[model samples]
Target chain A: MRQILHILTQPNDPLAAKIIAAQRQEPDHQVRVADLTVPEADYHALLQEIFSSDSIEVW
Target chain B: MKPSWLLIITSDPRTSARPAEAIRIAAGVGTWKKADVSVYLRGPAVLALSEFADEFIDEDNYTRYFPIIGEFGRPIYVEQGAPRLAEIGESPMRYQEISDVELAALAARHNHVARF
Candidate 1:
């Protein structure tokens, strides 16, 4: 399985949802999403995800 | 070795929330001791480095990421000839002014580049 990380820069962006949903459909892809727009987001954990993921998509 | 991540901010901060978000990301990513993170401000986004940055911050989503970013102490890069450069005055952030060509080289040197 491939680790896929999705970094969201915008709030409520349909594109992010659409892309993540499509990625989830792939049986071999393990997807994770991080929304940076949240006031209390833990960026440190997000960085860990970013570095560990085989694929990263920013939206 | 840690991978270098460069965040390029070119949006108009006053008209958009992108600049603040980019900075927030930089601050968050900076916390990871293993990731080499840097920020590059060009165009109107350069304004975010100045004292005027307070005006562009999205208060609702802001967590005062500047101090965090500052504490990380990476040299932020600001492009020369940004629009209204004179009006912005001195920036509290430590930045080095680089030309467009230098910007290209800087981006090329990074392992990952994200533009906002």
Candidate 2:
């Protein structure tokens, strides 16, 4: 499965979120969200993992 | 050079000072740390493109550091969405309008991403 990273900054940007979820639902891809707009406590760790991973596709 | 910073210029002209500060940061960091810096024009930042030949020549003008973008071995990228700014028209550099998804991917490719 491909690990896709999405940095979502807009609450209005459902497309971005939906894409990530779709990827995750399918075995072909797994979506991880950074939730950049309102960075949560774990956002930094999530970002570090995604950025450090080579198999991750960021959007 | 390590990698480029996807600099976004989306602030108003009166608020151009904010971008100027960002430019200065790029110049200083690129010069000292050998950073590959790339400026991306988005939203209101597209206005910087049209200011190409204006008072941009002033050293005190924050734009003076813009040339440093190229000097430091970085490309000044413009958004393709901003139709008003064309290299031939008024904006000094070329622009590309990429999807927000693509922008995110770009930010991902870089080692560090900072927004201003």
Candidate 3:
């Protein structure tokens, strides 16, 4: 399965929700979400995820 | 080798300060870092580099950093299906139109990717 990273810059973004929902159902994908707007988000870890993920979506 | 940084600006400048901040960050990275920095424009952010770009300025941060960005002379890549694609024709800045497939490849190649 391909690891897909979803980076969210907006809180409760509807489009991001829709895309993540559809991707979650795919058999060949493993989805991970990182919310950048949140206070607890670790920038270094997120940067590591950005380079490691097979696919990335910023929304 | 210098790390490659891909800065993607997808926010609508007229509606939010994200695009302006994105531009400022791009400029900062280009100016201060010993890295290869490139910008990608798509969605509403494409308009931020158009001839009517002045209209989209956040007024809060864009006005101060727009000129600084020019000093770096980094290539600004615009997505093929971006909104207001026509308005960006022959932009004074170094602008290149690219495909979504290419954009994906670009992000993969970059050492870091930041989207706004």
Candidate 4:
């Protein structure tokens, strides 16, 4: 399984939604979406997780 | 030695005053703190360059603060592709136009970056 991380800076960003939908269609991909509009500590933790993932996309 | 800082202000003053206030205070205090500062206005933040900026009179009046920033010998840059750029052609205030690549280069040159 491929691990994919999506870092979205804006709330309800359309691009992030589209990417999530596309990844959901792929059965072999595990996709996670991290909204960067959160608190700084939460954002750092999410970033750390993204660094550990197989692939990452930022929007 | 003072550290160089890139202050990227991308918030719309129409929506909230927090971002404008943040830039105002940063530029105001950063100068006395002896930090070399640069400002880049992008997105809705470019609207701050319009003549309408003078009408913005709050307790922190960002319009007034901007000139103080310039007096501190800090270079202010406006993004070439900012939506409001054409509406306010040739800002009365001292600012240079920069492309996305140039903006990236400026950020890379700075020791630290703060985005509003």
Model 1 residue B104 lDDT? 47
Between prediction 1 and prediction 2, which has the larger lDDT?
1
Candidate 4 lDDT by residue in tens digits, B31-109? 5868777788887778777665644434246666767777766567988876688776556577788876566445545
Per-residue lDDT tens digits for candidate 1, residues A1-59, read 76777778889966346546766766776878889999988899998997887656565
Comparing 2 and 3 on TM-score, the stronger one: 3
What docking tier does model 4 reach? incorrect
DockQ of all candidate complexes: 0.04, 0.15, 0.15, 0.06
Please tell me which predicted candidate would have the highest lDDT against the true structure: 3
When summed lDDT is taken over every stretch of 10 residues in candidate 4 chain B, the lowest stretch is B51-60
Error of 3 at B24 (Å): 0.6
Candidate 3 local lDDT, B6-62, one digit each (tens): 777877888878888888787787777697778888888887775545667565455
Give the per-prediction TM-score of chain B.
0.87, 0.71, 0.82, 0.83
lDDT, model 1, position A58: 65
* lDDT at residue B88 of model 3 (Cα atoms): 62
Off by over 4 Å in 2: A1-31, A36-40, A43-59, B1-3, B52-59, B86-89, B93-105
Q: For each model in turn, which proportion of the native inter-chain contacts is also found?
A: 0.00, 0.00, 0.06, 0.00
Model 2 C-alpha lDDT versus the unseen true structure:
0.55
Looking only at chain B, model 3 earns a TM-score of 0.82
Model 3 misplaced stretches (Cα beyond 4 Å): A1-59, B60-64, B70-74
lDDT of 4 at A52: 72
Listed per model in order, the count of residue pairs whose N, CA or C atoms clash below 3 Å is: 0, 11, 0, 0
Candidate 1's chain A scores what TM-score? 0.92
Candidate 1, lDDT over the whole model: 0.72
Q: Which structure among the candidates has the greatest TM-score? A: 3
